[model samples]
Target chain A: MIKLQLPLTEADVRQLKVGDEVALSGIMVTGRDEAHTWLINDKPDNVRKLLEGSVIYHCGPVVSKTDGEWKFVAAGPTTSIREEPIQADVVKEYKLRGVIGKGGMGPKTLAGLKEFGAVYLHAIGGAATLLAKSVKKVTDVIKLEEFGVPEAMWILEVEDFPAVVTMDSHGNSLHTKIKADSDKIAKELIGN
Target chain B: MAFKLNKEKFRDAVLELIRLTSTELPRDVIAAMEKARDNEEPGSAAKSVLGSMLKNVVMAKADSTPICQDTGTNIHFVTIPEGISLRKVEQAIIEATQQATAEAYLRPNAVDSLTGKNTGDNTGVMAPYIHFEEWDDPAIKLQLALKGGGCENVSTQYKLPDTSLKAGRNLEGVYKCIIDAINKAQGLGCAPGVIGVGVGGDRATGMIMAKKQLFRKMGDSNPVQQLDDLEQKLLVDLNKLGIGPLGFGGKTTVLGVKIGAVHRLPASFFVSIAYMCWADRHHEMLFTESEVSYD
Candidate 1:
């Protein structure tokens, strides 16, 4: 498996292709529906630097606190399709080198990845407790009060988080290919 | 003498049920996943995903952490004796739900429709949705299932004779509809999942029956031979799609296909499917003779 550090370079992301399993170690940010809307609508300048060459995860983690320090209990990828509308802009404006999520994104996000030299990573959906072990620490969090726990942005430090690149900078999407292939097989199996 | 319910005892028992349901994967589900894992070619994405899922299941139980981050909606199917009060059971369940959220057995999932505010306590309208049934036995039975949002989104209803697919209002039509749902689901519903199909009722009842089928153990067979045959055939056909785990493509697309039928009006034929992900967490508890047992 390929090991990736946070704040990856364009060249680093471009080298990856669809179906390459990777272990990511470094900093990442978690965002969901409300956080995505906030990013595109508010156009916040604060996170721009943090997002540059970094990945945004589509996750709503179950977190806890002990001795005044926060920790993750369960953190798994949510469906990425929900962020399709705003994902392209997030990638382009943020100069993000990678997007880590599950299920995969739509055509717009694929175009964004190709244009911006980024890759879309698919974290295993439903493998929460196993994946949470990769998170080394919880550095910070934002929008906890307004958007609640699930929608808040969680900035984290991770080590060896596992994912597969289902969409690459080369414009290959496993989701699209699988959908088309499955559809044709489905039709034949049904038989008109 | 009138039977009196012990509200506190029931509430505490419900909390434990919630905890076990959230943190543990059912044995039948785990066995199916292991079988899928063994069938996949080594070094394939499908095998890797199944491996992770199995490991995660073990870890969740060991640490008593949630199996999945979503924690999902809490659905309760309550069966009680005639003398029991629905209000009392619902109140106990609600209190248990609140306690579960605080203890991290569930994430506060209920959000206000307009305001988009989290209830913080996992209680509100339709929270921990309850369905009631009357049973002759003196024991009380409660079944809880934690359904994740991604899988729930893919669950759907279909009205036949869909001209587009040329599906008729028969078992054949039901098969076609289920195939379509599985293909469309592709890895979004977390493939290598469970497919629950309900035929014959109105739109609402069809869906209700579909979800009810989920409580059945994965290994159990429908007593109806026709439905059982369909279940077996569909399982094979779906795996052929090669959607694999999370759509990475390989073997083992689905673990099981369960179908239930209900009588409907002559004019309407609706087929409802409730898709469940591999992290299927469902368990039942029984209370009788002042003692409780869980499965």
Candidate 2:
């Protein structure tokens, strides 16, 4: 397993291949539908500055605040296909090196990953408590009040956050193969 | 099975159910996961993912936190004896839901569809949605299933004789529909899932039956021999797809496959699947006038 730090260089992402297990360290911003929409519609520089060379996690975390300190109670990856329309744009606009989510994005996003040196990391879906253990702290938050806890773009500092490279910068996607194989098998099983 | 519901403690009992269901997965699911883990090649991604998932399950139980952050929807299937005041029970559940949200046993999942705003309290119109069943037994039985949104998105319904797959309105067609649905779901519904299927009912009833099948404990067989056989067959077939945990591609795709059939009108043949994630956060609480026990 390779260990990659935040603010990853194109070299770091390009070296990753499909099926490589990785542990990410440093900061990652949690962004779901609301944040992605805002990023594409507004193209705000404030958030864009934070995204350069970093990963955007598709997560809606259950969080709690204790004495003004934010903590992630449960944090797991959400489905990523919904972001397909905007992912390529997000990667190009933000200079994103990686996207952390479950369920790989579409060919558009895969093309974007190849064009811009980035990879798609598949986090363990529904492994919230275990994943939250790696989040060191919530450094900051955006749109908390307007979007609510789950939708808010949480700026998280993490250590050794586990994920697997399902989609590589070279345009190879484990999802593509698994999906095709599963489709063929389903056809055979309908007869099996 | 014949008892009274201690109305005074009913809300508290539901709250306890919420906490337990949220933090801990039932024993059967954990065992299935363990078996899947053991079945996988050592040091494979599927094994590692299952390992972390099991660790998360244990930690959430020990720490009293939600097993999954999404904590999807709070679906309650309540069975009560005659003369029971369902309205009062509904009020109590709403209160319990509010308390659960504050305690963090559930996420505020109720979103205003039009406004795009969070309800914050996990309560809105029909939120914590309760479906009531009347039973001869005097005991009040409450079953809670907290389904996550990711899995919910992948839940699908089919109109059979699906020409694309050359499926007909028979058991064969049902098998085809199910297989096709799982393929489309891939890991999106969180692989290593539990599939609850309803066949031969109208759209509404089929979906209802499908979801109710989820409450049946993981290895329990359907009363009807044919459905039982179908369940067994689909369970084996789905895992063979090797969707693994979170669609990582491994031998254990589905933890359980439950199928229910109802009589349907000739005009409509709908098969609905309520695909559940591996978390499978469901529990049943038996309430009497004096005490409450959970399974």
Candidate 3:
């Protein structure tokens, strides 16, 4: 597994392949539907600056407070396909180096990744508690009051956050391959 | 003498049920996952994902945290004795869900479909959706399932005898539809998955009954002989598709298959599937006048 740190360089992201496993460290931001919609509609300068050269995770975490400090109880990836409508634009506009999500994105996002030198990292879905262990601290939360908990942007400091690169800057997409392969297998099996 | 329900007791019961089901992967589900893990080739992505899922269950339980971040939509299936108050149960469930959300057993997941607004409390119109049934037994039974959005998105319904697939209106047709659905899902539904199938009924109830099939234990066979045979056969066939965990190619794509049938009009033959992720969290509670017990 390759290890990555925050503020990933274009060269760093470009080196990834479709099946490379990665363990990310440093700062990252969590966002989902509302955040995506907000980014596309307004493109806030401060948020863009914060996200510059950083990984964006498609996640809605279950967080709790203890001793007056917020902590993650569970944090896992939501489906990334929902962001396909805006991800390509966001990646290009923000100059993001990496996108971490689950289930992969569509063609538009793939094109954006190739154009902007970004990679789509696939986090394991449904493994929330295990994923939470990688988050070192909750640094800040943005748009909480506006988007509510799940859709809020959670800026986190993480160490060794694990994921796999399913879509890379080189135009390789594991999702596309798996979908076609599985379809062929299904057809063949059903024929018998 | 008429039995009276205590609102506080019911609310507490609901809250506890939510907490337990959210944090703890049911034993049956764990067993199936472990079997899938064992079945996969060593060092494969599918095996690694299953290993991670098993570890996730342990960590979630040990820390008293939610198994999946989504915590999903809370579906409550309520069976009450005649003369009991549905309003009281509904109120208690709503209250329990709010409390659970605050305590972090559930995420704030209920959104306004039209407005795209998050209710923030996990309760909105038709949220914590309830389905009612009347039973002769004196005890009130409530079954809760936490369904994550990814699997929910992949769940599909089919009107069979699909000519494109050469599927006829029979068990063979149902089998084709299920394979087609799984093929379309391709690890997107967080396979190895649990398939809950409703063989007949109108659209809504068909889906509901299909979801209800998820409550069955992983290895339990359908009571009906034909359905049982189909369930077994489909379980084998789906796992052979090689979708694996999270769509990473390997063996052990589907963990279980459950099928239930409901009465339908002659003109309609709908098969509804509720594709449940590996985090198949569900539990049941029985409330009597004096006490509440969980299964």
Candidate 4:
């Protein structure tokens, strides 16, 4: 039931810990597999300027054009582990304070969250259509004609977006904790 | 003998099916998720997570949008009449996929596996690999599925030697293998999901059958009595693992267990398990000549 806002400052991100409930509000950038590669390998200019103090959502949205106006139909969080190799670097390079995605990122991203003041938020996986309602507006879109909708970087204004602090600046990760516990149960079942 | 299909009509049908399936979370899945939420007696944390998930599905349906941002990579299986022309069907699928992807505003999920290039259309060479089976029936059936990477990654196959099993593919063995997969996958496959099991075939055939079997409606029992009994037993055992909703820990880790089996030689047994997350977005359609006139 804890309430919060987005475009989190370095101090704000640092104060949060794993297991904190949050309702994010502010401008968050949407990026997924292709967009992550473009950021790390291509190093698109002004990417830092665009992301500084902003939240990055690992999502690709379903959108349509009606009478020349683009509207989102559904947007849901993609798995963050797919971006594990590049997430920490992307966070550090862009000075990002928050990332929103489903499942959880791996150790490197967790380490990066600790080194840099950042937090990883878990959105409900498979709730794309419902999650899109949080988006108030799309300010601008980049790389659309080239990368298409899912791969393109969509800059959106969202209000009170819900998420949980699955990973925090202190290197705590809910995913890791759960996995370790599940593995213990698994091994016992195997009589190992 | 040429079977003709109206390309536009076929395409529109596919698009509408995708839209319907994407927005409306299937009834069985909703019931499963809700049951999981209520049965999560260990703690309120997991219950709350499942509750939010239920709410999310309802909201997405009301809004006519995708329930997940990862709309998923389109995978289809087409069974066409022997005399039907497949060219039109194939083209319709690709064209319909592009249009639906654009209209549904699906995320560009198709990437070149080797080069990592994004195919904006969500189709490339063999991208939407259509497994075509020539059936004696006059009608064509298309099974459409959006295979999200999260669940796709958790699919597993075990090449079992014929001599290793004392009971000739017993339920215990299948149960153990499934538990092994879930344990290995952990929360990676976005658990509290369905497991599609394909048993007694070659490696490739078993895998394909596993994927295809997911198209079956949730909660439907297997036609084979032994397999049905095994499915029920495994469903109970899997839930006991307490992987809970999204692996946060609780009851109800799996919504259902589906088994598709084919006869195999006495020398080998191949078991393939494919996990489909709660998103489990899929639909089925039957197209007959009587439904619409073909040019």
Candidate 5:
């Protein structure tokens, strides 16, 4: 039941722990597979400036434009593991305070969060349509005209978005904990 | 004989199916989650998470919106009857997919593998990869499945040896392979999901069968009693692992187990397992001239 305002400061991110329920409100940048590749390879100009101190969401939303105004149809969380190879680098380079996605990131991202003073937030995986309502406004978009709407970087203003802290700056990850516990149980059940 | 389907009607149906699927967690999935919530003995935390997931499904349905943001890559498994011309049907499907892509405002999931170019439209050269299986029946059955990359990423295939030991054909070897895949995947594929098993087929056939089996409705038993029993056994074994909803740890990890088998050559035994995430968007329809239908 923790209420958090996004574009979170380093100090604010430090206080969060794994398994904390958070309702976030602020500006978050949306990026999926493509944008991540660009950030990792090219280090696009002004990217750091755009995302600095902001939360990055691993998502590709379904959005419709009517009368030149864009509206979200379904903006659900994408699996965070896809970006694990580059997430830590992206967070450090951009000075990002948080990441919002479904599932969870790996050891590298968890370590990066600890080193960079950040947090990884897990949004409800299947609640795409409801999540869209939290996006108050679309600030801007980039690099997805040809890729269609999903791969675009949609800068958005959000309000009271919900998430759980699955990874913290202390190198604690909820995903790892759950998997270890599950595996132990699995091994016992299989009588190994 | 060639039957022409109205392109606009086809487009509308695909869009509607996507919309419906996005907003609602199918009945069986809901039931499985509810049962897991009740049966999970770990603690109140896991139960609470499952409870919210159920509530989220209800809200998504009530609002007529997508349950998750990842709408997934739209997959169409079209089976045409022998003697029917498929040119028009194929053309209609491609056109309908493009139109639905625009209408649903679906995220452009298709991308060039090598150059990293994203195809604006969801379709490209062999994009949907329609496999035409000639059936003896006069009617055509189309199964539409929207597969998210998370679950797709976890799909695995193993080529088993021909040697059989004392304890049967070594089916445990296949089970172990699948368990390893699920283990390596961790929570990435979205747990509390279904695993589509394709056994006893050629490599390509096994893979396709695994993918196609995902279109089967959740909770429906396999037509063959043996396969149905195996499915039940697999379900129980998978859930016992404690990789609950979203892999957060609980009693019910898999909603169901579906196995589709085809007799293969005596020399080889190939197994393919495809995983489907919680946002399982799929529907079946029978296309006939009398009345345009949707499931």
Candidate 6:
């Protein structure tokens, strides 16, 4: 397993292959549909300053506040395919080095990853509480009121946040390959 | 005669159900996950993935944190005693859902489709969706299922004889639909998954019934013998696809298969699948005039 720190270099992303298990450290940003739309439409300065060469985690975290500090109750990845509509543009525009999500993105996002030398990391979906442990602190939260809890872009300082590279910078996607393999076996089993 | 509801007690009951269901994985689901974990080759991604998932379940239960961040859409199927005001029950659930969201037992999930606005509280138009039916019995039964969006996105509905797969309109066709849906889901639906299938009914009811099937305990057989047999058979067939946990590929692709049938019009044959991720969060509560019990 590879251990990567955020603000990853293009060379760092290029070295990753599809199916490489990795643990990410340093600062990362969280976003979903609302934030994606906001990014593409507005290209906010705060986001560009924070997102350059960093990973964008597709997560809407469960958060609780205590004494004015926000703590993660549970934090897990949301489905990535929903972000496909704007992800390619977000990648190119943000100069993103890695995209962290589950369920994988579509062809457009994969092409964007290859073109921009980024990889799509698959976090374990439904492993929210476990994932929360890796989050060192909730450094900041962006657009909390506008996008709500799950859709808000949260800036997190993380340590050893685990994920697997399912879409690599080389234009390879484990998600696509898995689908094809499963489909072939399904056809044979069903005699189609 | 109608049984009067104690507003505070009912609200507490719903709140407790939400907290327990959100924080804990039911025992049967835990067992299935454990078995899947044990069946994998040591040090494989599937094994380690299932290991972390099982660990997450344990930590969530111990810490009283939500099992998954999404905490998902709260779907309630309620069977109330005759003459009870369902409107009151609905309001109580909605209120309890709000309380739960504030308390962080649930993530606020209800969103406005057109505006992309989240309700902030998990209660909005059609949020914490409740389906109510009156029963002759004296007790109220409530079943809640928390379906995460990742798995929900991959769920499929088919019009049989799916010509693309060459599946005809029969039990065999239903089998084909199940396998095909799993194949398409791959790791996307957060496999090892629980598949609840509804055969018959129109599109809407088919989906509702399919989701209802998930309320059945993980290993419980369908009351109908044929459906029971099909459920068991499909479980075996799906695991053969080798989709494995988190789609990394290994043994044990599916955790459970549940099938239900609804009466349908002669014109349409719809097969709907409610694909549940390994989280598989659900619980049931029974309430009477004096006491409330949960399982």
Error of 2 at A55 (Å): 0.8
Those runs of model 1 whose alpha carbons end farther than 4 Å from true positions after fitting are: B1-3
Q: lDDT per residue, candidate 3, A39-140, as tens digits? A: 889988988877999989999999998888889889999998999999988888887898888888899999999999999998889999999999999999
Clashes in predicted model 6: 0
Error of 6 at B136 (Å): 3.8
Q: What C-alpha lDDT do the candidate models reach, one value each?
A: 0.91, 0.91, 0.90, 0.77, 0.76, 0.90
What's the C-alpha lDDT at position B157 in model 6? 99
Q: Write the per-residue lDDT of candidate 2 for residues A1-192, one digit (tens) a residue.
A: 899989899999999999999999999999999999999998888987899999999999988878999989999999999999999999999999999999999999999999999999999898899999999989999999999989899999999999999999998999999888887887678774
Cα-based TM-score, every candidate: 0.98, 0.97, 0.97, 0.89, 0.90, 0.96
Query: What's the TM-score of chain A alone for every prediction?
Result: 0.98, 0.98, 0.97, 0.95, 0.96, 0.98
Tens digit per residue, CA lDDT, model 4, A1-192: 566665567888888887788887777899887788889998888777879888889877777778777777777777778899999999998888988888788889999989988999888777666677888888789888777677789988888788888888997888888778777776555443
- Mind giving the per-residue lDDT tens digits that candidate 1 earns over A97-126? 888888999999999999989999999898
Report the Cα lDDT for candidate 5. Answer: 0.76
For residues B222-256, what per-residue lDDT tens digits would candidate 3 score against the true structure?
88999999999988888878778998788888989
Runs of candidate 3 with Cα error greater than 4 angstroms are A66-68
Q: lDDT tens digits, residues B124-180, model 4?
A: 888777888888877788877777888888889876632332223655666667777
Candidate 5 Cα errors over 4 Å, as ranges: A146-148, A189-192, B1-15, B41-45, B134-138, B161-169
Which candidate number maximizes TM-score? Answer: 1
Sort by DockQ, top down from the best: 1, 6, 2, 3, 5, 4
> Where is model 4 more than 4 Å wrong at Cα?
A41-45, A66-69, B1-7, B113-115, B134-138, B161-171, B265-268, B292-295
Candidate 1 TM-score on chain B: 0.98
DockQ of each: 0.84, 0.74, 0.73, 0.50, 0.55, 0.79
Fraction of native Cα contacts reproduced by each candidate: 0.75, 0.77, 0.77, 0.67, 0.68, 0.80
Q: Tens digit of lDDT per residue, candidate 1, span B186-243?
A: 9999878898889989988898899899998888899999999999999999999989
Minimum summed lDDT over a 10-residue window in model 3 chain A is located at: A183-192
lDDT of each residue in A17-49, candidate 6, tens digit only: 988999999999999888999999887887787
Residue-level lDDT for A19 in candidate 5: 84
RMSD of each: 1.0, 1.5, 1.5, 3.6, 3.0, 1.6
| Interface RMSD, model 5, angstroms | 3.2
lDDT of 6 by residue, B113-196 (tens): 888788889888888899998788778889999999889989989998789878888999999899889988888888999999
